[model samples]
Target: MPTETEREESWLTRDELEDVRGRVPMLYVIAVPVRVGEAGDLDQVGLLLRASDTGRMERELVAGRVLYHERIRDALVRHLEKDLGPMALPRIPVSPQPLTVAEFFPTPGVTPYHDPRQHAVALVFAVPVHGDCAPQQDALELAWLTPSEAASTDVEAEMAGGHAVLLRQVLAHLGQTL
Candidate 1:
């Protein structure tokens, strides 16, 4: 059997991934990072600021693809650490479950989510982090906001690709919808 590293090394190249993505709905993991109060109440949600492919800055949740043979929980941890620094310390359960499943279509209006590059099915999770988070990789900054603030029109306008809708779903799942 191949080691995990070896298996990861066998992943498709960028062009191959794009070709396959066009032919099928790709699976993805989306995370909404949260900070909890002493009572374990969700105090704030974390969103990343990044410049999109279109050259405009946008707000987004921690999200990425689940590699071949990778477990769902492992994917969550990997993306969280990749986007939110290694010290984010996400609290993934032993058997993690998603808050909801979101489907992003290439065409808009099919669903609230839209990804023009490809159709993607995302398992959305609400993850709590106990340590400090410094935005990493393509993320310019990590902004922690209250649920109401996150639901505001200003923040909503800054988010694209259905991230604003994802925020509402996550907050509703946590019983903190604005």
Candidate 2:
């Protein structure tokens, strides 16, 4: 097994962290890795099932906090690999800009997205993966759903927090009306 120092080197460490969760917002990147058909139409939407901080199973997109010196693209790639298996090859977008910026507030009713843990600002993107995906670490399952199926009320209802809105936004961006 890897030592604590090795693990800490890969991720963040307590000494390098700050208590800025209350004083300021954090930067994050959210990815919606997809598979497309020959015609460039969206074929599948990837969803990750993981245990949230509250210990409940929640459906979430590939998301994580951006480290102090990490670029958004690098963070997206890192988180995607961490959640999806390392074998899962993600096609990071050529453009660095995100599809949307979601602001998650600690308090409810502040926005469509709420993170009771902290106030986070996320740059969301739609990534494409060309390799097989196996859930890793905290992710229990990696589910692939059709655009229409993903937009279904049942699927939306299963999404916790405001990830459902992000899903809808992705569909809309793909020219599909929910």
Which is the leading candidate under TM-score?
A: 1
In candidate 1, residue 148 scores what lDDT?
A: 87
Put down candidate 2 lDDT per residue, 1-178, tens digits, no spaces: 7876554335545543456676788999999989999999999999998887779787889998998668888898899999998888998865577889999998999899988878899999999899989999989999999999888888787788799999899889987775
> After superposition on all CA atoms, how large is the RMSD of candidate 2?
5.3
Each candidate's number of clashing pairs is: 0, 0
lDDT of 1 by residue, 1-178 (tens): 8876674357898999999998998999999999889987889999999999989999998999998888999999999999998999999999998989999999999999999999999999999998989999988999999888888999999999899999999999898847
Q: Model 1 off-target regions past 4 Å?
A: 1-9
Cα error of candidate 2 at position 49, Å: 0.9
Q: Could you tell me how far off, in angstroms, the CA of residue 17 lies in candidate 2 after the best superposition?
A: 4.2
Task: List all candidate RMSDs to the true structure.
Answer: 2.9, 5.3
Error of 1 at 16 (Å): 0.5
Distance (Å) between predicted and true CA of 141, model 2? 0.2
